[model samples]
Target: MSSAPGADAAPGSNPIPAPSATTPTTAIKRQTFSSLKVRNYRLFATGAVVSNTGTWMSRIAQDWLVLSLTGSSTAVGITTAMQFLPMLLFGLYGGVIADRYPKRKLLMLTQSTMGVLGLALAALTLTGQVQVWHVYAIAFLLGMVTVVDNPTRQSFVVEMVGPKDVRNAVSLNSANFQTARLVGPAVAGVLISAVGSGWAFLFNGLSFGAPLIGLMLMRPSELYEVERTPRGKGQLREGLRYVAGRPELIWPIVLVGFIGTFGFNFPIWLSAFAHSIYHAGASTYGMFNTAMAVGSVIGALLAARRATTRMRLLLGSAMIFGVLEMFAAISPSLWLFVGLLVVIGMFGITVNTTANSSVQLGTDPVMRGRVMSLFMMVFVGGTPLGGPLVGWVTDTFGPRIGFLSGGLVSAGSALVIAAVLVKAGGLRVRVDLRGRRVRFVEREPAGERERESVVAGVG
Candidate 1:
């Protein structure tokens, strides 16, 4: 259970061993930072941390800017919608572009466009000439760019360190994003309080420079080469068929869709909670986000240390997220509610990072772009469609019901999926009487069904 089949091994070799808790100090010395041993991945991670921090800052600033500009919750929802709508419409096509083009060069172009877009928004907002329409226009444009940029960036990770290090790389990528989430919002809050939202936007624009430069500086020879597929009859259909044929690919996408639509609409709920439930201002909202970011950072770090790619942990964590959200929804005190959010955020990122890593690690190298795009589409594209409904629920029924609805739906979906996976795989679930640990095992038809539990662990 510790070492997943063929995970973290040289191609065609045995899997790397899971480090033992009782191993001597001398034994530990031989282990390496498998992914970072590659120079290109190190550079990419470093640059991404710098850029991702800026992205988070902009997110916080953008939300605050919209809230300040119009005190209505609906405006914030609209801003979120404009940014995610294109992903719903064009995400699959973005996969096609990633498959057919040179991802590095495509990324360079996309990054530059993003910087320009961010700077344009900053200039507009700073001069006091910005209207709601301008924010909408900018959000839509940014979404359009991300439609292509997202898949390209996702596909680019595999090439950075290759398949052997892919799981670690993906976990580290989540860590980087979460780390940025922690810094960016705190910085944005102070900047917005002092000068205006414009400087936060400007910093985001500048953040693009790091990744752009990192892409340029990569040695082409060290990168993994994904062959470009020629345009053919039914190419996109082929990608769909490819996914349809694989349960490993299809189920994770379904799980993420459910989570994204319900569990992931945090900002919508957070904004309402801060203003209505907590009776706090912009700074309080920032603190709420920062707390979530703190939890996310911890989740990402824990995921980075994982040696297995099993889906059970992810599914269970998602269940925990739903349960915690429900706890937050009914809490009477602001401190208790914020504390619940911290736990919710922790498990939320754990579920997301685990699902993402599983899907990517399970995929074929040639098909990764298409697969990941499909994954991203379901995981992110569903947001725009769901956000308005969530927003309306928050605005109408109130924040508690909105949170309750999402939490219940998420937990229900996960329970259903867990049952299906268990039945299909003929899995046995075992519980130890003395501890909180549970073990699951896959059983052959001829095997003793009651004794099939493969391993045990603390839940």
Candidate 2:
């Protein structure tokens, strides 16, 4: 098997390897969907698709409902912020909890709680008792549950498929979610337009059963074993220190933090674009989301096909994603805008899956939960800050200017991070205009080169 960069390094002390090309084996090349060959993961993925579809449905419904009630993009942002606020506050603790408990059991509890919350929201909306505060309250509660759920679910992938297939599984998971994204928004748009958001919420509430049942059906013996961290103090501090010491792990998390915080406020942007800019209805909003999902699915599949993750890929994709968003923000026509959304979705998922797999592979299995929590905390948790800010921007300035500003931040941060990584790695950028290529090459001092030559001769 092709080794991931720094895959063999000690936890918290991994050396950041200089950029290198990867060559996959014939067998590895043929196993794009290799993770699905395992029955347990297959079952897990099957159930996830159903639940994720419901999730997207609920998300679209919730955003639309808030906008409909308040007629303000900022309110939709507040709603989105409420749903992710707990991650900002309590995300690290959730990871510790995941490490201390059986992931399957933890998942069951979190999933059930989320499902109930969905039902409760549905009841409020259907009975005509729903208010902005009710939606905000339920969203906050859901965020609380997700604190536990996100890490448990993330760390569980390695157990289901083992390290060999973790990257593939991660990519497939994205593909699965994007696939649902493709379906959920379309269905939600129709439901919201016809009956109201209530039924969409109800469908989401019922969707949790699929994953719960799948968890129950798994053969525990067939799953890979990972050592669970015992209950103790200092664990949270340890997780943080472990990550802080590892440049490979910490830098990617930082890059994702910037991208996630500013680059991914799609709910606010899309809703504003549909409602105010295009003067379109819920169906058009759903269509916009669905178009993006199509590109995301393609991106995920491409990631699944790769045998190795590279730092350059992550940086390049992030930069591209931001640039595309900037372009899409200014597109003059609806078709041109929708087309850009597709490409933006593609690079966006690429950034996500690459960062995810890179972090997971570099981390020790024992510390995986906490490391992933930090990864996720920066990735989604910052939404509490970004969502409201972007929402306000859209409300005050206009959707075009708001989106352009986010894109600028995302692209700019990526460039800065790339420079930092290059400097830290003691590497120089090599530009071969003749070959039309750019590469990172180690900077070898004359003394070091002479020493290496003498040593090679002696050997």
Candidate 3:
């Protein structure tokens, strides 16, 4: 049976239910924790929290390990790029795999592969046989698996909660990830300082067990399975064709590519702050990350309460996030800089979560995997370019310059995207300070009034 409210109503016999200001069911679903009501999602979220924490721990440990070996921020940037490069190259192929196969089974395989890789890295580090090259190799290997894992994991949310709560589920997912970020780095910091980075890696390797167990315990009957995309020629081309026709999809991907490339060079920036600028160490680095996570959590929670994603919100938040990050780059004191990062983190998460939810919601069910794969490809995969650029900036000029440069590019990109949206959304950017007016002017179908609501948002 169709789950929509009026699905069973006779075509012309019954009076329609009035769409009122609010209803009990709608009110209940508006709550931030609404998605947790589902057993599968709850279980999966529980497992993910544990696993995401471990992932963060491994990330921090990996970067720190690289710095310790090379003493160069550029090397750290390279490591970051290497990890993401595979996703840039192969993310679409993963999407095809995702569409053709069962998502749950694919997740299990990918998750197990990740766990093994984590353990292998831990073994190498603990045995003191680890080198920057070894770390690079392992990071690249991990990214290879993530090419498949990223899209599958992203598309799996709908399977857990169905289409109705997807937005809420995605918001909660970000909240879950940020919460892990908050806890993971703090724990890893202590573990790194007290024992060594090896222990942190080992702990992360062990943390995979929780999610694996959760997956094992899920009831197959409860899974909300979408139609499996059948094998066929030109499916990949079709996915590309679908995205090409939508401006809403194109703009977000384009904007995210810029931000992800320049703005999200955090591993390089934060690492340099600790090792190069602050002269502190692992604890301070972890603290920096934790503070950012704190803001991210808050941003995610706020996103949950919002009615819908908007173009103004996305561009506005990105602009603010970039400017704040630039400001953090110039802060004179470590504490002051850390304080700035907190606010930056908030805006960053706002931009990230909003972009993700918007893209997923706007896409078709069958085409979602490919669409999201492209999104991830542009967002994380752009690291191949951004990482190296930021690294070179950090090494040639200074960490502060790298920081300032990234923010400048990020904020600039947002402005350009805003302009693109203005023209493409059938709206004009008019500044009338003398007339005391500042708002979007909706031009008649003179331009793209059509795609505006679908891509950008309603004015």
Candidate 4:
């Protein structure tokens, strides 16, 4: 027997519910930082702030080092590509490892390895032996570590704070990262201007101590119990099938893949703008990033306040993100471009947080590691393809053309995917000219309702 449309349904059973105008006042009033109340998560987040700041500092330093050494945007792209290539090739296996092991322990090992890599780079750069190739090697090794670290860290949040606060925790994680971003680049700029990239790398290498200590100090007893998957074959295949069957999971991943591969090539574009177009130096580059970080921090904080995620919100934000990128790409003045980047950062983080929370919340706990690995893979792994290509476009044509092309692809993909999702859900656009409103509403045909009911039941 099929339940009637609009009837109460188990969470995750209805993959696509129509948007509601009225959110409960209590949900609205929920504190944005509620997840920080958990001791374990608080520790983890505190450590993350220190480490993420170092991570961002390293990123800016690394990019500047490569550009200074090679003077070719293509070479910079190659460096970025080499770093993420591991994620493209070995990402699924990393997820398997994350599932079968204790995430906290795995994170400890990975973080330690990454710290060593950072220190090694620092050593080379400080000694004046740092070639572009040295940075490339280190970046690739760092990516290899990230293959394990990214998914493990992502799935670890649920254990720290439990399900009820997972979304809040995820939002706070973004906020933490963006907060670091707000600080990291500015500091890196001063350091690079006064000293060089070597000191920044050294700081990053040493910063890992914070996370290591935090992890060691966490009380294991307070963590939510989650069943770890046993060692087994075909787990990778099983994960692929799981996402392949779920529209909610699959669609977001697909959308991110498109956006990530094309739209998120900021390293290439930002550097080119600073070097070629703006005729500026490392400090100006850092300022551009800082401008974007300001918006990203705001966006993450806003996302933390929302108790729920919506597909419409994700799509809308993504479209706006693409449009803003396009405008920023062509701005005549440096400050105008910087201003556009702020709005771009806002919408960019909005898309990221919404998609992240939606996927994490909708997924089964046991499958989370694999699911998140796939998410991270697409979200970042595609950088290998995007980085070089965007770099080439920027090098061969100009930064404006390269950036504009990425925005075009991003916006075009969102529109196409939006149409596909609407059709799949048997939905129609409801426009009320008098109210100046538009939203998606269910189609009224009985057959369509029956079909949707059947699909919901199966899901």
- Best candidate, lDDT-wise? 2
Model 3 Cα displacement at 134 (Å)?
A: 0.8
lDDT of 1 by residue, 134-232 (tens): 988998899999988998888777777776566677777887888888788888888988998999889999999998888777776677655555565
Provide the lDDT at 423 for model 1.
71
> For candidate 4, lDDT tens digit of each residue in 1-459?
122211111233223222232233356535889999999889999999999999999999999899998899998899899999999999998988877778888889999999999899999999999998899999999999999999999988887887777878888899899889989998998999999999999999999999999999887767766666887889999999999987778878888999999999888999899999989999998998899899999999899888767677788788888888888888999889999998998999998998898888878777888999999999999999999999999999999999999998888888888887677766666766999855676667665442221121111
Per-candidate TM-scores read 0.89, 0.91, 0.90, 0.91
Q: How many pairs of residues collide in model 1? A: 0
lDDT of 2 by residue, 318-371 (tens): 999999999999999999999999999999999999999988888887788898
Write out the backbone clash pairs for model 4: none
* Candidate 1 structure lDDT: 0.77
2 or 4, greater by lDDT: 2
lDDT of 3 by residue, 1-459 (tens): 122111112233222221221113234437888889988789889999999999999999999889888889999999999999999999898888887777877888888989998999999999999989989998999999999989988987877777667778898899999999999999988988888898889888888888888887776666664655777888879889988987767777888999999999999999998888989898888999999999999999888877566667788899998899889989999889988988988999898888888788778767778988999999999999899889999989999999999999989999988887777766765556999744566666555452223325524
Candidate 4: 10-residue stretch with minimal lDDT: 450-459
TM-score of 1: 0.89
TM-score of 4: 0.91
**Stretches of model 2 off by over 4 angstroms after superposition:** 1-27, 432-436, 444-459
**Candidate 3 accuracy as TM-score:** 0.90
Q: Give all candidates' CA lDDT scores.
A: 0.77, 0.86, 0.83, 0.85
Overall local distance difference test of candidate 3: 0.83
Report clash pairs, candidate 2: none
